[model samples]
Target: MMVSRRETLRLAALGTAAILASHPVAASAASKVRIGVLRFGTVSWELDTLKEHKFDATNGIDLEVVYFAGEDATNVAILAGAIDMIVTDWLWVSRQRSDGGDLTLAPYSTAVGAIMVKEASLIRTIADLKGKKIGVAGGALDKSWLLIQALARRDHGLDLPATSDVVFAAPPLISEKAIQGELDAVLNFWHFCARLEANGFRRLIGAEDAEKALGASGPVSALGYVFHDKWANENPDAVRGFLKASAQAKDLLARSDEEWLRLAPIVRAEGKELAKLRDRYREGIPRRPVAEEAADAGRLYRVLAVIGGEKLVGSTPEMAPGTFWQEPPK
Candidate 1:
């Protein structure tokens, strides 16, 4: 369910106090603060921690969570003044900033997402892709696929076409179509990758390749928390307390698997697919941000521009100033 703006602030303030009582290390707060959160695979950890009482009942701001199909959808919530903050990809956030949205980037979340394919398929490498139909997500599949191809062309010496035999579908259907063999392969983020693996599919390549050894950021790992800059500036104390409690949550997730498992249902939604999504995230997409990743934000913006230009028409994605919030201090 979507959280209204008033309720978001109220709950955030309550959650902040709750976190303080438990940790006692967070910044002091005078009143409650609220945050509206988007629902997506990348920010799933923040959602989990928030839902798990990790942010409630203490010295932290209370977080009210809302699920969205994608960052763009969450952008709607932000525009409505319904959400105070968001955790999403830098690409969409940049676009929002360009749109004159008053949002600020606070911290990096996950990095590049990944691409997956079945082992039984003939698609073996980037060069092997040509006529195969690929399933993609949320109307951005073609753009994402083109982004992958751009990297292959720029760094790996591969030739790609202006278009492909890719199939566009929503998140839930893409995996199912790929599994049913209706599509050659589905390019997706990690949750689907893990689910496919559990169901016997082989990974093609993923954003995890960004481990400093792959000559690339690998698979796009940075996801960051976003919020209204105007609101955040007025609530610096709220921001500090929220991040403080979130830091604890990050540490907790890093050190405990049982805790993650317990919150899986709330985060991913219980079922076979949800189980696979939970496991997929566990294998990759760490709960903490890669602090140094702040440098790569510009590169991500440019890459997105190029792919969106050729693959999308009508308008170009915008890059916003102060779109990414500066990395928090260690």
Candidate 2:
């Protein structure tokens, strides 16, 4: 009528095995992916969707979001092994790889900034920007600013920075100054540009347009999910799963206006501003093939190298090999 000790132990082992088999993710610690993100970054909208829709778990991974105050902090976190991935540009990945680091990127957003002007501003062409006060965010090395400069020189033979009163400041400050009429034109980040559009500002030229004018074939992603090659190779499944989850999230955001409404608070927008932000975010989603994007990036790199010099792209005049991560065949 009583079970033996050996039989009891066998039953316990079977029960534990059954539980682990039913929940595979709980059985493996490697399925957890820690991602570093900016505290106010738009990437959070997609990440929040992933969690809300349970995409990560469906993809067989636990997504952990780590927030930092700035981009540099996120970079430090990923490099110091505090997180698995962060959203950044391929240019940065190329720079790091050239300097003996193994970071790689998966395209995130093709959305880039624009040169914005007030509705009544006389700056209708690149030539009109001469002798005007302009504000630029992300400083002298800002990719969009550099691209705009190249565009001005190539198309109009004007040295934009040299001829204009250029002011470089934080994105928010630049946006504020432009609104206050302290600057005649401004080149700011995408989100800020969206806000400016909502407030009646006009886009003189978009970064994507500038790239095309400067010889790129199509829209190229300027930002992506960056991670170390060693870590990605070791956790291939987790990395792929996370990327799949991210893609699913983007699809949802693209198709659903209700989803954008839900994200309004996080994005700090409402009404016209919210709609503008949503539209711009959707527009920025990367749709080109990886190879196509990489080819454009290589061409764009040469242009940037000419202006940014050794300080911006390091010693590599070309985009480093493997700067864009190609998903392994299924």
lDDT of 1 at 99: 47
As a whole number from 0 to 100, the lDDT of residue 92 in candidate 2 is: 79
Error of 2 at 20 (Å): 29
TM-score of each: 0.73, 0.91
- Candidate 1 residue lDDT tens string, 1-330: 223334544554544453335334223232345444445454666556755765644545665555555544455555555556666555555554554556667664453445667777778876666666777774552434556767667665765443457666776799888788887777765566666777768777654442232233433444567777776666676777777677667666665666667876656545565566555554444433443454455555465566666233214444456766653454
lDDT of 2 at 228: 85
Model 2, residue 216: distance off in Å is 1.4
Instruction: Give the 10-residue window scoring lowest on summed lDDT in candidate 2.
Output: 1-10
Q: Tens digits of per-residue lDDT for model 2 on 1-330?
A: 112223433544544353234434332356899888987898998999999999999998999887878776566556655578899888878877776778999999999999999999888998999999999998888999999999889889999888999999999999999999999999999999999999989999999999998888989998999998888888899998998999999999999999998888898899999999999999999999999999999999999999988778866789999999988877
Candidate RMSDs in order: 7.7, 12.3
CA lDDT of each prediction against the hidden true structure: 0.57, 0.86
TM-score of 2: 0.91
Instruction: Please report the candidate that would top lDDT against the real structure.
Output: 2
